[model samples]
Target: MSPDTAPSAARVDPKLLRIAFILVLGTFMATVDATIVSVGIDTLAGEFGASVAEIQWVSTAYLLAVVAAVPASGWLADRFGGRRTWLAAVGVFLLGSALCALAWSATSLIVFRVVQGLGGGLLPATGQALLARIAGPDRTGRVISIVAVVPLLSPVLGPLVGGAILGTASWPWLFLVNLPIGLVAMLLARRHVPAVPPSERRTAFDLRGAALLSPGLAVLVFGLTEVSHGRTLPAAAGVSAGLAMLAGFAVHGLRTRRTPLVDPRLFAQPPFGAAALALLVLGASVFGTMFLLPLYFQTGRGLSAGEAGLLLAPQGLGAAAGSVLVNRTIDKVAPRALVVTGIVLILVGTVPFTQLGHRPTDALIASALVVRGVGMAMVSAPVMNIVYSRIEPAHLPRAAGALNLLNTVGGSIGTAALAVVLQNRLTARGPDIAQAFADTFWWVLGLCLLAAAGATRLPRTHVGKS
Candidate 1:
């Protein structure tokens, strides 16, 4: 079937399911790469004789590259076929991984990580476009839940996986590990992923819009990163400029006859607009907190890297469980119900973190994380799927890019803001590390509350077909 006319979601065929499963491997790898190096920051600092702040650039650079590359995915997929574009992206990622593994210095490693993120950015957006084209709006939640499995698990498991590698192997092995998995995924995609013939009608690409969108997001994220270092004035200037550029792009997108980088009209639709906002906050609260948790275990509690990772594994396990449960109940539960209930659970679970004193028991932390995991799974998967339900088949790639971009941008902002707050408190007279972490966790809870409020704005159901 030509993907230009999307299939009915209620009748997802065996071939589509198989193709979705294949694409998820790439998604898993991309999401894992986002957080895998986080636990290795300390190890990299030790090996390179750098400080913790210096090594953080490794993560910041990758995130910045992702912000830059994501807007280009839609254009790439439209200009090249999904199959060819996807293959090229995975190849680029593998090449970057190889470079990162062989990096001789801290600067070299950080630069290679940027290369890796540029490649990694395309995977999830392209994969979403692929799945959305085949499954259509009716069963978007089910397929999206499957596609979402890795992202939910990766943040929790990444640190653990990285910790294990750092414990047993050199820090380089973190990048080295992507080699085999990426190859296998590339092979599967080549064999099974459907090739959609390019459309006869052309929407000319907007080079000016693309130029403005990518760097604006990158500069915005950079400004947030600067906030962590107490660079208030410079960060403010960068942020203001970034906002102006983005605002300009939005205006240009609305006025353009050409195919702009992202459609400004998407925000007018309830499913895409409200759900996107919900995801933005979820990213900040859940994914953003992911960056800080391992640091809390290792720095605040003085646990070994491996131990910190293991301590966090229950959250991932709970998230996996929640995804499975949602898979079974997706048709029965309303998207709004799932989002609001999830937010409530998340808020309740986070209450424990704010009260965690020095040396709180592992069982307590793990239990709370489990509940938060289930809540996050409910929020992230369904909200994302809801966006697809609103978009047309032809617009799936653009929608995917825009949604992924918003989520990542929110996550970078959340991580930076919370980190800044945490760092500032840590400099107090004889600072209590546990208390500092707890204080920052309260910020996460506050974000979740905002997300819960936003959930009310989402549609009660997908719009009926025209």
Candidate 2:
């Protein structure tokens, strides 16, 4: 499977393309649902007669479910077939969406959201694995570049779609929108998604390892989420406990040797290990910035939620553009060079935000967002290509799942840590929300720098292209 010998383009059937598009649509649905709810939080709170803090759990619960279920994706795909698993996931997501829309109370909505998250979590990793398998050794980069757009631009699309639904209809429509799309995806998936025959290796389920890892991640993310609400000590304790459990899981994984939930051997490869670190930092920086941008607009600049969301769209647009460009050039440029360049652009983009005044215009924010988006576009596809290229095809599913797990956890940690930093600074500064946000932007800038340093460790080779 040398680069020179790989296929230039995937020999995908016309039917498979339709199926891939359906899968991508489902992926988009899940991602958009996660971010869209943020825009409707006020409405949801009023409707359910709940406090904003309680309503926040809708988002938190969804994220937690995603983290919990991500590691199981590879296993599920192997146990069932990819097509069967994907269809089941979409069906569950649709059902959850319907339940969420019809919820009589916040508590019920949270429960439904957990179901949604479980289903959504599988799309990213499983879909990647399917694409890799279908495309074979050749054309992995090209196919992945196309798939990358679904998640990359989802944040931008989510708010706009949510805002439109909120304005014309009710919040229920937000979930209802998934029904038609999910039905279409389910039908197409059954027809076109190829099934991988189950392995006859007879490995055990590693239930103990799963129990240790899943709850550990949950506690860790829970601790981080608590920081935004001014609960520092509890948050710190939760994170500590999570780390201890994760360490225990690692020991269990090593000792058992039959079949760990995650294969520890993957990290033994230098490129794979480096790529994982890059994902962690990149997740922290990227998602953390996303969490901060809206607050900066709403609190610092006095923009409404809708306005802030519209402004964020440019970042998504820019990222989409960058995904296309990077995917094309990844095979030509060294992975380290591409990663470092992307990170540097992201850092430079944050520079304008650090200099914001009390009343920044939409134009200024849009410009900066576009720059940040470009940086994102530059980084994401290349980083993914590098990670997958280093691994053997047989391990793609597991590796992709592990990578995605790190990504989700990284985002949770990054968002929570930045939230804590912003909260502490705001409390200390008092009535200077703008300054506090600016200070946090500076911190995000620093993280981007750190990510740049991490990028250097990636293998110095041209990725993707044959």
Candidate 3:
């Protein structure tokens, strides 16, 4: 925001700026809903008198439906047009939100949430496609900076908002709040988002590819969550069937002449593959921790939901600051170096969480969140720059879809896995709630370390190699 950098930041046209607003609004509503409802789980459980395992479905169902829709996004957008498709998606999400607010029981809420997820999944995939198309190849960092804001900023605020609503109003308002925001997003899409008319030149829809990947991913995520919940037979069946279908899709994409829906071929590129892995690790680290952080404050530290939310706001603020600083300098260094640096910060920032005890000071926790936020901004903001700049422009939609799916699945699985770990540790560790939660933080730290190491595999720059 300094005078020197003002012009570079303003490189995108007014039309694209308008489009970016629409995309970010959709992305914020979709991504924030995934976690905002997370804080309300226990409240919903109490309201419906449901068990912990049963209430989990309220969140898991939404995530699974998101996975189901992810593989179809690129093709759907291509066929229907991005602007039209985005508007429809926002409209569907709004409808789902309204229905969810009216849910009379836990089962009703879970079903309505699935409806929300189906629409939510399209927002990020199409949003990224629009962003990449507008920014062009050279200015990818700018688009990434724009696209990254929603994910980095929303998680910090979601719990705070969810907590405030639950504490003041009611659980239903959690879903109801999205209604006005989503309507505004849909309205903006009309003027800003360009309608890509179906191209005679575009590849035919790969029914085989769609058939294989979408359900494959859905069942795969379903199986993982079930396994986390300690269900055996159903989980086994789902995992086996899902993996086989995904394997079938990979083979189909390789042998067929037509383009695949979720092309396995994109992973072959070094930069693309590296960015995908980075995204997976980033997703796992950010979301898995987001899933746990509020609980840690509320349960371990005995803070109220509202207090816990206020405690976590620093992370979002730090991320906003980090993005501004990192984007200004990202192009000068090799992405590998920059990404690794971000991971190091993540490791450092996250280390503090694993060591907290009873009645930890507020400043200590907020500082940790601030550091982690900045770390996340550094990693997430520039990754799409590496991916979009490296891939062929025509492949943008599919590539965008595939990467977004990886993130959703990675984060969901990571969150579920960590929750399971926390459950087991609480039982095993003699009810030392702080230690059990700390044990879960160790798992988060492991994810960050894995991500940091993986970032080194990204293509090296001449300066980086030297």
lDDT agreement with native, every candidate: 0.82, 0.79, 0.80
Identify the superior model by lDDT, candidate 1 or candidate 3: 1
The per-prediction tally of clashing pairs is 0, 0, 0
- Find the 10 residues in a row with the least total lDDT in model 2: 1-10
TM-score of each: 0.94, 0.94, 0.90
User: Which residue pairs collide, candidate 1?
Assistant: none
* Model 2, position 228: C-alpha lDDT score: 76
Candidate 2 structure quality by residue, lDDT tens digits, 219-253: 88998788678787988898899899899998897
Q: Report how far off residue 403 is in candidate 2 (Å).
A: 0.8
Model 1 CA deviation exceeding 4 Å by range: 4-14, 49-51, 232-234, 358-360, 428-430, 462-466
Ordering by lDDT: 1, 3, 2
Native-referenced Cα lDDT, model 3: 0.80
Candidate 2, residue 452: the lDDT equals 75
